[model samples]
Target: MYRVLPGFHQIQQPNGSYFTVPDRYINLFPFKVDKPFVVQAFDRVMERYVVIKKVVLPDSFLDRQPWKRAQRELFCMLYIQDENVVNMYSAFTPAATREEMTEFYIVREHMQGTMQNLSPPTFGEHRTVKSIFFDICRGVQYLHAMNISHRDLKPENILMTRDGDVKLCDFGHSNMEDPNANTPYIVQRYYRAPEIICETMDNNRTSVDIWSLGCILAELLTGRVLLPGRDHVDQFILMVRFLGNADQLFYSVMNERARNFLNTYREFLENCQPPTDIHSHFPDEVFQGGLSGQPEECRMARDLLFRMLVINPDDRIDILMVLSHPYLAEIWDRNMNPDDIPQPQPPEALRNFFRFQNIFAPETLRDEIFNDLREFGERFNIFTGSKN
Candidate 1:
């Protein structure tokens, strides 16, 4: 059984445990706007907040669950074992009320908004992208120093306070440095490494995280998802198009242990050749490269991005080397203050734009369809009623 306590209007679980912010808060504010909402606890008087979550595991997944309560226990232990990662004041199991039933939750300190919200200088935001990448590198370096792999890293998971400091979050799907391994690879499909799909067959570690970060770096520069795809298969295809396809030698590069693992998936990868001339499929300007910034610096960033988004995750750079990369050093040497960065206005005015369907084009017929769907859902109770 778990314990729960009252803190002002919010609830606290046992030390070191994480519980989802009550649904009331889960779909609130910026978090609500973002899907797969994050949990947070807010204090009105102190102007402080805490992140809390409870991962509800389905009973049917008892045999196939990738991690355990003990793994979560160990995740809490990492905060104690390493300091480079974010600080966790406490982490313990706690009781959560769900209707008439009660269960456990996970809780941790709440970090602030992420770089996704930060607007760079209109004069040239690419420099701001370079500066932000340094902060990301430092945070990632700290995680690697502690031998932890933040496998699910993305802009949303990387929190940036108003003062411009950075903290990496979302360790639920991370890989801890452990000698005895139990599960296969795990990551959000878009950011997932190819080794998980192709060669190692899901044996993931530090290198996989570096690859994900690289993709994130590219996205930050362009304000778009670098390898956006509809689903895992689409993402994999996009990856092959941007980067070359996995070679036959990829499996041979692994050790005997991994090679033995590859035997099971050889036939699958053999037929997994990506479409030829993937780069040619990209928009002409995307390949022609007309963005701002020193061409050399831009090229450097692109080269690093390419290496990280490779078809083979094993070929990607690790945290240590990324930290040592000249691009990072050059960016940091520029001595940028996030506050001083200029923000360019959106191309079109949004004063009259409706909030519910904040899609790019309001005139498009899809907006009308979406507005109708929203109205129907609200009137007919197509979706669940609000928890509050």
Candidate 2:
């Protein structure tokens, strides 16, 4: 029974089970019902506060007979060791009578907001791209140093506190070192390294994570995804374009059966089309792939990002080299001018480029667009190549 301030309150369930009621409630900001939420139910009947969380693991997770337990073990270890990691207070197995029984609740300490929530498009400059990436790098460095590899490191799994610090969560696919064992096949396809995708990363799971790290950095900077693809096939097409054709290692991951499956789709893969012109709002003049930031300070960071997005994981930069590079130095260098830092802005030419003289306007707001163009005047040179 849950201990209340003066007495005990029994929690009755819609199902047959019963539990204790909490003494006090803690508000989880922006809580969603089925998805990750904020409000946490807690009890502090005595001097100590007890918090409970309801976690449900799908039954499908158990279908993978080989890796189900392993995945759980990995998550449990990672969760408990890393305080920055999502904290799980307890867990309960589902009731035995439930059909398709894939439910279990993992009680956890509720964290504040997700990285997506913190860095919403509407939120103005607080943590710049550089700082956000540095924090990520530090977290990654820790994971690598501990010999752990987070197979899926995406923005969705990144949790942010009220103070704005980021914590890497979701270790469901993470891998820990086993000296006697070889690295297992792991990685979320989109963030998947070229080597891993190509099967070249036989034991290089760490590099795969680094590749995702770079993609994440680029997204934070632009507020637009750098390598967005909807599915495995779409992602593969994008990667091949950047990385070229996969090597033997890439083909090695698939069994003959899987290879045969791919062979059937070979014709379709060959016919896939690339975007006519990939639009990067980044001005060509300002972006010198190697010349950005301080040559001695931000070089590693830049090069690593460039490499991570490379079509081939085989050619990607190793995180060790990335961590040692001078480019990363800018992360901690305070002497740099804040004003010199590059901020995300639309191209100068695009600002006032589109001007419609209200010719089609109901004769009302037409003037507003023209007035805006007038205010923009010569300061904004809008260009539409097709208009010519």
Measured by lDDT, the strongest candidate is: 1
Q: Write down the RMSD of all candidates, one decimal each.
A: 16.3, 21.9
List the candidates' TM-scores in order: 0.61, 0.58
Query: Compared with the true structure, what per-residue lDDT tens digits does model 2 show for residues 1-388?
Result: 1222232233444343333322232322224444442234543322222233333333342333223323343234323444345554443322322232223333445556667677545323323545556666656655665455677788767777666677666655655543333443455555665545433334445666878887786666445566676865566667655545555455665446545765776765556543343322232223223323433223334454665665445566655555444455456464333334332332323212211211232222223323332333233221101000
Candidate 1 residues lying further than 4 Å off, grouped into runs, are 1-30, 33-37, 44-47, 55-61, 64-74, 77-85, 90-110, 117-125, 177-185, 251-291, 331-388
What TM-score does structure 1 among the candidates reach?
Answer: 0.61
Superposed model 2: Cα runs more than 4 Å off: 1-30, 33-53, 57-84, 87-110, 120-127, 177-189, 194-204, 257-302, 310-314, 334-388
Clash count of each predicted structure: 23, 19
Model 2: residue 290 alpha-carbon error in angstroms = 19
Each model's C-alpha lDDT?
0.49, 0.47
